[model samples]
Target: MTSAYAAVYKEWRDDPELFWRKAAKAIDWIKAPQKIFDAGAGVYGLWFPDAVCNACANAVDRHVEAGRGDQAAIIYDSPVTGTKRTLTYAQLQEEVGTLAAVLRKHGVEKGDRVIIYMAMIPEAVIGMLACARIGAIHSVVFGGFAAQELAKRIDDCAPKLVLAASCGVEPNRVVHYKPLLDEAIELAARKPAAVLMLRRPQEPATPTQGRDFDWTAEVEAARAQGLFADCVPVAATDPLYILYTSGTTGAPKGVVRDTGGYLVALEWTMSNVYDVKPGEVFWAASDVGWVVGHSYIVYGPLIHGATTIIYEGKPVGTPDPGAFWRVIEEHGVASLFTAPTALRAIKKEDPAGTWLQRYDVSRLRALFLAGERADPDTIQWAEKILNVPVVDHWWQTETGWAIAANPLGLGMAPVKYGSPTFPMPGYDLSVVDDLGHDAGRNEMGTILLRLPLPPGNLVALWNQEARMRAGYLDDFPGFYKTGDGGYVDDDGYVFVMGRIDDVINVAGHRLSTGGMEEVIASHPDVAECAVIGMNDAIKGEQPCGFIVLKAGTSGTHERIEKELVQLVRDKVGPVAAFKTAIVVDRLPKTRSGKILRGAMKKIADHDPWTTPATIDDPAVLDDIADALKAKGI
Candidate 1:
């Protein structure tokens, strides 16, 4: 018997237009799409071409009108600042309306750009919804981003207004946002006309005399005057937002999401992929800056009438490893979505699930992992502890939702150790060789999606059509190159090994660094590991494993290293050329919990490298350099 997931996928594959047309009915469209797709319209055609809709109305106003006014729309939990707050649908509608009025007062009109630079705060969500309400395109840059990086985004999007907070709270210190914003404005050629700064008690900022306005003052004045902005309908093909993802050329690639397509896609995922229902709490432990946060934390849950969570804390810090559990228990979170890096950090600190036992997370139905490859070791550990379906999905910032995921609402699929299940509806996944031909089963190659990418995927790069084509489409003509290297198994399970560049050539023999890391991470003493190809004059590049041991692990580092080397040799065979293994206290990661493998490789190769602006801690890079030096690499 075919699984429900497989049957639904076939239904979609049969007629994508009919499938998307059915999905579009879920949204409250001002003008429903008559044409599902227009092949000649955009970079890869367009979805819902004749539709007109307001994202904010569907997300906030409709819920209140549907008698869900008292339902909690958002739960703000900030352990770092000792703050917890909740907003009902009615309350959120009022807040978003007032903010939209304030934006209108400042001459921000439909199609005008607004940049939101805020910490994990309720107001950040309000800012985004406010922009959507007024048909203004909002671009969110991560708070505390370097002035230069922030300036690059400002120039790229050329926003008319900026929304920001006073400061961001970390476990140890406060990162002031005003200074960075000020410096960024000074650096940008195209400056925003105005800035609205939210004053936080932690570190209030002195605004620039001419350009800055107090967020509370503006919103309160608008509210007192009974000014509430109404939703403005925009064409479905209009750009909703521009989210910047890092590009190889050191320039930010702004990914544009269409209004109607985004609303439809996210709404479907909330029900099908995550199996979340309205009124139940769903938590995506990520910052508003990242794509996951944009899709799940802010847009998806709200549109679906589910109570979303904005958690401002780390997996291990800001109290302890039990922070996630506390939120789940307190909020009755039905599902949790986060990066695999977070679970590994928690496992490193509390390998025995000691912290987890303190809280009752019986309400959690499933745990969704993304952002990075979810190794088998980490998934198994989470499954053994949570006693819930730990689903590993694959997606990118370019694709707003999951590319490959096991549809929980349809029915559960059998768990595959390393695969991220099958491709979700609308994504026609193909594993192709370097020359664009289909690779055989289980053969490592580049992954591509067939032409005319589904709704919710990026419409185009902001003002850089040539770059988008050259970077993604040109490489594999007729397909959208995923840039990832992986293969489909006999059962049609897509296994994303790593980036195509991650496949290193050793003595003219290709080796997957992800394959080697899997073996090393399976060690009993290891909590997490990263394998990078080190420059070797003899073999061109040799695999070097860096392992982080679990808390209270016994035995010497040298002994563990020897065992890891032997483990990889046994699993990946002698052809892997994996001789070196180094045990480290911790691996360097970005603020979003992605291991900085590229930076690590550059360091190991003794090449010129600079600290990544997104790094969680600069000191961690120094530790890695010291470790490499100690090993005489």
Candidate 2:
């Protein structure tokens, strides 16, 4: 079986270009483009040679054609309500196909944008796939985003149809999405044609300005009306989805991903990095707004015919630590993928208590962690608690593909904590020096990919020609600059320090704020830590740490601060010492659980909080800032 799996991988890897060409032959092609090799002009690559295709075909239709229609397509779980739904590949096809007809009947056609405001629900999945199936481009704003945030996306996309949920229960609270959309529509100059609403918890919410159409009624009407929507075969390079990333500077750019290139990259990465197995359960815990959700949650796993889990609600919902375990138990999830933030909390909550004891995780063979760097402590915590080897991989949205992965089915056991371990096949990782030269052994430099083009990375951001050019091409010139600082160790494992700006320069000595957080988290008194640099009269910049202590760990400023400072020094050398360590009850975090270091840094520097668009607890920043100020800056 091992050799057979490898043989399959090798046969495809050896001629992936050929394999993709063949695999795509199954998709219905429209007018084919005439240029597959226009990439020499820098950041402008034409793909699919003018062939027309639907994203849903590769994700669903083809899987059915391969006789895997009985296989599970999606296993959806609601952690807050403890409800579950499973759709088979055939069932998915019918649902998406039916919905595509309804969308077409409603005047959502090719080139039209559809705004999806929803959480992780079957309707949301069906809506996105249905749009892809019928050639309407989708833009999914995160469900946690407020009306102001959703209005920006809606105005930008200018969608013809808005697919939204009435309301949904999150970990701790009920979100009223219909009211938000209604508010946004009321604020809009040109409202969308209609808002198709899902009845979450079957609660009948107030209608949206006479434009609200009940989804259940509409879907049923479409089936009853016997309307079969015609498929509009889009050019392979046609836009599939427009994802917005909060720019480091300026307004959010609509990052457009088209049919062929995007899906090809996603399918390639899923099969290669994760070793996707047909009929096996694959769970990617990301909000649909994120690129991870777009690719893995909707595209990659579905295309592979793997059963993907769409989990709604937070990891720790209400007052239970076993929310995740219950989902795994309910679904019998085989492959689990999540972030280290959730892992850290789970480990902290149940140090020696086996939460996995609650589930039949026998089906769970491989566990992967990404999104951000999972520190050595998180890795060890997972190992001690979960009893499953937590494989850490690294990538970015710009790269499109996972550059570094601990590839499945390969048995090499050099576990370098906090490292991606090795360069994945078909990619090369180099730490280039400031002088545009490669670094020496164990020396840090700007991470650059030796690139003509990798399979998974985008050629450029859509529509913004110069924006794409400046973001990727102009920076490193010939190399894809990753904007990260890392070094390949003597053992050839790549150790990522953090983002270049995330490094603290204290008296001209480069120190990673991430490194300090790792050491601080290891202390028994600490639950989490966020580190940043602040200006000082003398040292130019000083390390300032904001940390949340473990429950009941005496919150006195003098005692906790001294203990943490000494703990870091003892654990990771005096080089890791902070100028001041602050103890707080909470840290500002995104709804996705990423600590808002950007917001914290803004507060520390007296700058505006530009990126805290959907903060879970915005008031946490105030408490943290107050605590930090009490320590005399």
Candidate 3:
């Protein structure tokens, strides 16, 4: 009954260097490093420092060289635009080469930073690979990001060029990105030298002659001239990309990922965690702007020579609740990965599972959930309805890939309800107390990882090495503090409750809001829920729950609220102080689908808080505030 992960874990723990070295061989490195890992320099450990390789070569050219040129490398499905296209490996290589030549012709050089602000299209992937081909670093901002936010990233990275599309087609609207890009450049302190605009045929925008140029024309001209950018060799530790993470407070921090280690680690995850084989269609429903898209959607699958699906549509919209199922069926997707929030939306929109049953998902091998903690209710519901093994894994933007998963590639472990199973081969994780000491089994504490972090993990904050060290390493000296509160059970299964700061102090006891949320979400009528600590003069802090009900379900607000309160009280006890509940039409969330608990807390506390640029709907905050006031809280 033992899982294959047990044997793999034993092998990994016995000699970590040998394990990683074997993993590194999956890619075709131009010059392999003699050393496996070097931690002598600083808190930011270096892996394969002496190796020289091109990320583009490993992801694109190598497969074509191996005679897999005719295989589909990417399938672009944009339900918003009613478009579907596939690019073979050879075609993608040529397109990437042409774009790289265009970048070089625009004076982009090795080691220069390029800003990519494009939609979730094949062109975005081309831009990323083109930068990698020329050894130029790329910083991709989410297409939906506000001009102010994009300007901030531009100022920080000081990219030589900005690559953007004219517009993005969403379910309900067409977002004009050209105007936003222009505004961001105007607001930026250090503007890029030039802007390459990808013009969509559906929504045309005029490009300025000198400062801006059409990306399509440049690529076509380069291809006609038989010009292509040659892949450049770069030291293993050379900067690959800088991705800025939008924090709940203050300025965003740019996470720097290196070239060599990222490729090796991601290649390993393809076979080890995702269990993906070459030519298999792997769909990660995420924007290319986020880390999941960078690691899973773009690089990981390509490095493994698997076909990746770049979807430009919402989980529920872009037609209906059947959109995802339709995509899976059409693409013959083998492995599917997405966020828990998306699953919640899908479950809400199609409560009876009628839409999901209409499509054939037999080709799907696994469904992975991340970005946020997957509640037990949603996981079980998805598994039951889809008839697939639904797994919940945990990681962060800092860590490019999954740190803990069920390891479906090895073998399926018995599902542990809300737990993400075990830590991966290279990650050393533990639940620690306030004193930085390991907590006992089943004890909730801060999650930490014993350094040095595995390859593919961030090396340092972009131009903020001191901040990186102080934020992660200095907290516990030897361990990288995750800033999340959770526990490891006796079986070694990890339960990520939520962010440590989200823990509420009720009277003298501390209660995790995520735990309360899980209970509330377990209710049949509840589709999704967010729990926050509201300031209370008597109890110090009380748990206030906001819930979104399932479609076609009808009940009095008072009755539903009472049921949720009773569920929390019964599950977490009276110490949780979960009395108040509000039914909301929608929860304020970031574009990435993370619940804006901080904003919810501010509204519940009756404090003033500004709408973040990352929020999908800023007015939802006002609605929540109004609902709170209407409840006389």
In order, candidate lDDTs are 0.92, 0.74, 0.91
RMSD of each: 1.1, 3.3, 1.1
Off by over 4 Å in 3: none
Tens-digit per-residue lDDT, 1-633, candidate 1: 235998889999999999999999999999989999999999889999999999999999999999989999999999998999999999999999999999999999999999999999999999999999999999998899888999999999999999999899999999999999999999999999999999999988999999999999999899899999999999999998999984233778899999999999999999999999999999999999999989999999999999999999998887999999999999999999999999998999999999999999999999999998898999999999999999999999999999999888888789898889999999999988777788999999999999889999999999999999999999888899999999999999999999998999999888889888888878989999999999999999999888899999988999989988888889999999888898888898878888889999999999999888888788988888999999988
Give the Å shift of residue 206 in candidate 2: 2.2
Please write out the lDDT profile of model 3 over residues 94-148, one tens digit for every residue. 9999999999999999999999998999999999999999999999999968988
RMSD of model 3 against the true structure: 1.1
Sort by TM-score, top down from the best? 1, 3, 2
Task: Put down candidate 2 lDDT per residue, 18-126, tens digits, no spaces.
Answer: 6556545434455543444345543645557456667788788888878988888988877577777889898998899899998888899988999998877888889
Model 2 collision count: 7
Residue-level lDDT for 118 in candidate 2: 85
In TM-score terms, candidate 1 sits at 0.99
Candidate with more favorable, higher TM-score: 2 or 3: 3
Top candidate by lDDT: 1
